[model samples]
Target: MKEERVKKILSLLEKAYPDAKLVLHYNNPLELLIATILAAQCTDERVNKVTETLFKKCKTAQDYASAEQDVFEQEIRSTGFYKNKAKNIIACGKELVERFDGKVPDTMEDLVTLPGVGRKTASVLLGNIFGKQAVAVDTHVFRVSHRLELAKANDPDKVEQELCKIIPQEKWTRSCLVVGTHGRRTCIARKPLCNVCVVEKLCHSPDKIYSSRQE
Candidate 1:
């Protein structure tokens, strides 16, 4: 059945990516929020590299709120979309300071209300920072879920809902971590390694094409 296949896939992925966790480097919830915002269309590796000095410069929500926009933009320019990202960070920080007592809001509803914090970012903040059950549907989760047939939904929110319906609440956060790692390592968006994939049998991709090519 599909449910059994889903469990098998999760088990394999959990084994493969036993240490999978949030890659973005941040010390506090506020920092994580800002880092996730900056991470749009950017690699976590690049974000970590930038955040090394960036965090040192701006440690608190108040620090970011009061920081000069030009300095912040220049510091994060290498991450790309510096103009918009800088603006969002400043606006988000101000909201955090004014609305949440300089602390990152723990709930998805409040977190999404902050500038540049969408459902994906809010999920990450909730799961990683607050230990709440939420599946952050980034590109990795979106692609891998479809590849594994865990979700057929076209949109991230719908995919997340489908996954929630199947996966237990306790596993939601860890499932995101595992699936994201699998996407990056094996079930990549382009040219996925179907032959070596542990969940290849469960994947809906052209299995005959892969088998024939291997033969």
Candidate 2:
């Protein structure tokens, strides 16, 4: 509810997950963009496993644009939603080539114009790829922000606004990384491990599991 309290919670999170950061493997902005799209409803680990071979095949926007739909689908089939994702990836590549000259746009406006790219993806790109201030509100960030009482909004965009109001601009990326890590490792969706959570005292989630037996 207060800025000081939110800062303290963020600090605790940093201490809890000292090495927390984006786990999705990528060598460049384009690779990260494709990886982010493929990561929809899929785990980073799984996405990484698929991209291990995908990046080798599709090196550029033209590669993806010209990639045989059937072959690309088969390559990324394990990430789920193969048909739709494949279509989007192809379209995204085409859009980049036609509009941005085969480069990932750094701005939010341009990034969202690409196929399969939403505000969340745009934010991730802005922060990590473009070195701008952004809070990528993925499912984990959304859920964890609510549980921590740092945001009350039902919409991800509104949640980002609420968090930005309390968290410093420089810490936007840090907040997403640490809080998201906490959501995945400690404050989980089904049963949060509040007993061992570093920010448990600051959290007010009704779903918190205070006892080991409860989890």
Candidate 3:
């Protein structure tokens, strides 16, 4: 996409969803790390619901590193993949305590070294928590980027690299939040409401369904 067109799309996206923000609730890096892990195949709403109690119970890395495995699994059972998530959270906590002095590392290199933390997860922490120029490509980002032609690669890491090339570094995180919200709200996977989409005219996806809206 051309720079001017990308600019227009981003401008309209901000206008369309001025309040779009991260749905997973967290006050610190540890909370977000846990919530992101729990959000693997689950909805942000469900992750938030589960983390409401989980955060209070596990406030620090030491708390998680020492949590009983079976009990921790039950705490996050509703998030699905609780067994793996629980195991990772515990091991992640241990790594954090042992290596980073119980603080979440700010760099991608250090963050990815922790258990269960991948590039996507590291990007979230980097962009949101550490105030870094990073774009985390989750399912919504991957789907919407394809629809908008911001990226064409099947691999998400490649897509992220492509997006980084076009989208200004300053707007990387905001653009992802806005576009991801667009995917969740209007550019839905099964039934996209193209008629009500803010970028309908700009989209060239074959799946776009057009109709006159009552509003």
Candidate 4:
């Protein structure tokens, strides 16, 4: 029953959001790494705005590694936690240059080893940049997964694990993009538009169609 529901939900979401993908603007793996870091607790729109200048200033691992800390902080200050983010970016870039020869590591294990990068960020790089089968359980994925009965775990790692088990390996990365987009457009945190949601019938939330009756 769960497996059938998962399939149905995935199918509906795929149709509803055919163009769903990573919204964070990045030119390359290194830019994606920096964008993901800047995206923490911040919206992708904001990150894109900040990265306009940030990317020009620090294009490569070597450029970021050699960038002045204060200057980098000021450039990305709008992303929040500027001090820590700047420090992490510099450290991560230096490590990327020294360890990976200025190339973003494709493996999850290697990507997570960098400073300020967690499973979420690594998953982004793997799924988006490398086209690897990875599930990135950001806030949207986390919420939508539970609401759709795709996962019941409290933590992102566990949720990602459950999703991986149910979703086909080939669809894992695309599923993240589709579901994340759905969450942003329909299954919003405060008030979901369940009445208009393409997968409303598949949603496990009790309030899925409750708002429709009020209309």
Each prediction's whole-model lDDT (CA): 0.88, 0.91, 0.91, 0.91
Tens-digit lDDT track of model 1 for 31-84: 898889989999999999999999988888999899788998999998999999
Question: TM-score, each model?
Answer: 0.94, 0.95, 0.96, 0.95
| Winner by lDDT between candidate 3 and candidate 2 | 2
Q: What is the per-residue lDDT of model 2 for residues 1-215, given as tens digits with 9 covering 90 to 100?
A: 48789889999999989999898999999999999999999999999999999999899999999988899999999999999999999999999999999999999889999999998999988888888999999999999999889899999999989988889999998889999999999989998878899887776678876844423
Ranked by lDDT from best down, the candidates are 2, 4, 3, 1
> What is the number of residue pairs that collide in model 3?
0
lDDT at position 104, candidate 2: 96
Residue-wise C-alpha lDDT for candidate 4, range 67-89, written one tens digit per residue: 89998899999999999999999
Q: After superposition, how far is residue 43 of candidate 3 from its true place, in Å?
A: 0.3
Report the C-alpha displacement of residue 215, candidate 4, in angstroms: 16
Model 3 misplaced regions, further than 4 Å: 211-215
**Which ranges in model 2 have alpha carbons more than 4 Å from their true place?**
211-215
Candidate 2 clash figure, as a count: 0
